[model samples]
Target: MTDSRDVVRRLREGFAWRDTPVGVFADLSGWWRDPELLRMLGPSLAGLHADASPTVVAGIETRGLVLGPLAALPLGVGFVEVRKEYRVAGEGQRDGADPMLRAGTPPGYQDGGLTLIAPRRLFRPGDRVLLVDEWIETGAQASAVRRMVDEAGADWAGVAVIVAACPPEVGERLGVKALVTDDQLPG
Candidate 1:
């Protein structure tokens, strides 16, 4: 079975530094298809926030969707999809104006960023949630989720990521736990 060290190695080998309009971000189109990577990543990442004993796991977007549920599985919690540029059908069961729909963008993907959309009902009042993703750059996505949690009156349990490259302030402010640190990234 793959271990956390193997996961780190795979991530570094898979990802490359790319200078985007926003800034330097990791082009992580590297290990998406590797089920083994995720299998190893799930429990390891889950371990980060499992101490909080959250009732739900919310994944931010495409990457969040993959890692969130995978991490949530071992945590024995349900997974929630924080959709981007998409809306869920039958949510709120209302036409036109659904109070459940929420949309915004993370600060990290400023230029040509995708509009993120999620249902407020995905979480409930007082529900504890652990947010999961593969990478965190600016804590913008994590902040958005924190806002949603506040709007719903849910408890922001914690944030977890497979790799991190953002400033230490981001993690300190959000209390995010990353499996891989900045030094581990391929420079």
Candidate 2:
């Protein structure tokens, strides 16, 4: 079993903490380079879906880009990237992604969410998908993507996150499972 507290410890050690105008933020660039963390978290997150047997794993842009692939590998499933506006070349649909998440730009993270445009064909009827993200704050992104999945006629197995700060109602409504919670963050 993945000790959820261990994952919290890894996150506290690997991520740099800060307070912004919006709220507390943790920079995850260093977390990506920490092999110990990658090793610890991948299977932990994938384990969240071990029983459901998801056919595809979908992740949001930026943070999810890394964690999603890692989780998918353990599950032995294909990975799909849910990207920011126009990030993916060729044909894709808009799912109203977070306008605050501008990669390689100042203030790279956003607390307030936006509608993201994702690929039109990420799923098919009866496709079981597990949505992955590094964190779940307001649950807006996950909720929006869940709507997309429903519209696509795909089964939303559930949402998995490394850490979550959303309220209990959000998690219940979105069917989210996380390794750690906002209250678990170490000082």
Candidate 3:
């Protein structure tokens, strides 16, 4: 297995920041471009929650969509996509028959808040779900995802992320583990 420190080093090497009119933007595109980092990322994140023995991995939309599947591959589990304000046809539609579980997140570093949605059928009553994402700033989305997991009757295994920028108490409450803390980022 690759050393966790090596992984962190590689992440830092690939990561960058860009200035925009609005604010500084994190350019994580490097993470996806490196083959070795891609190979190690899933296992590294999954390792954090291996003790939890999560039966399934759940990722929020966008970046989470990529990281979630990677983590799930190493754990020998399935991946579930938690979308943002996903809409479907009426309940009569076959694909839309299963109602989606929705939860509103609190204000975060980016926007005010977002509504997370997932199909009820994807999560089983006793599933141990570990949520994965690239970064977490406010823990708002993570908390909301946990709530959705609860509403789906699934067990909250924990959260795994590339960067953890949320407050210490928030991270502890959410049972979050990360590859690096926000302060560790290069200035």
Better of 1 and 2 by lDDT: 1
Q: Native-vs-model 2 lDDT? A: 0.76
Q: Give the whole-model CA lDDT for all candidates, comma-separated.
A: 0.79, 0.76, 0.89
TM-score of each: 0.81, 0.79, 0.92
**lDDT for each residue of candidate 2 in 1-187, tens digit (9 for 90 to 100):** 6676777788877767788998887877677887877887778999977788888888988888888888998898888777665455465335783322222212323644344555556666798889889888777777667777777788998888988888889888877888877677665
| Candidate 1: 10-residue stretch with minimal lDDT | 85-94
At residue 184, candidate 2 shows an lDDT of: 72
Error of 1 at 13 (Å): 2.9
Q: What are the runs in model 1 whose C-alpha is more than 4 Å off?
A: 18-25, 85-93, 96-98, 101-109, 112-115
Model 3 accuracy (lDDT, Cα) = 0.89
Q: After superposition, how far is residue 10 of candidate 3 from its true place, in Å?
A: 0.5
Predicted structure 1, TM vs. truth: 0.81
Between candidates 1 and 3, the one scoring higher on lDDT is 3
Q: After superposition, how far is residue 22 of candidate 3 from its true place, in Å?
A: 0.8
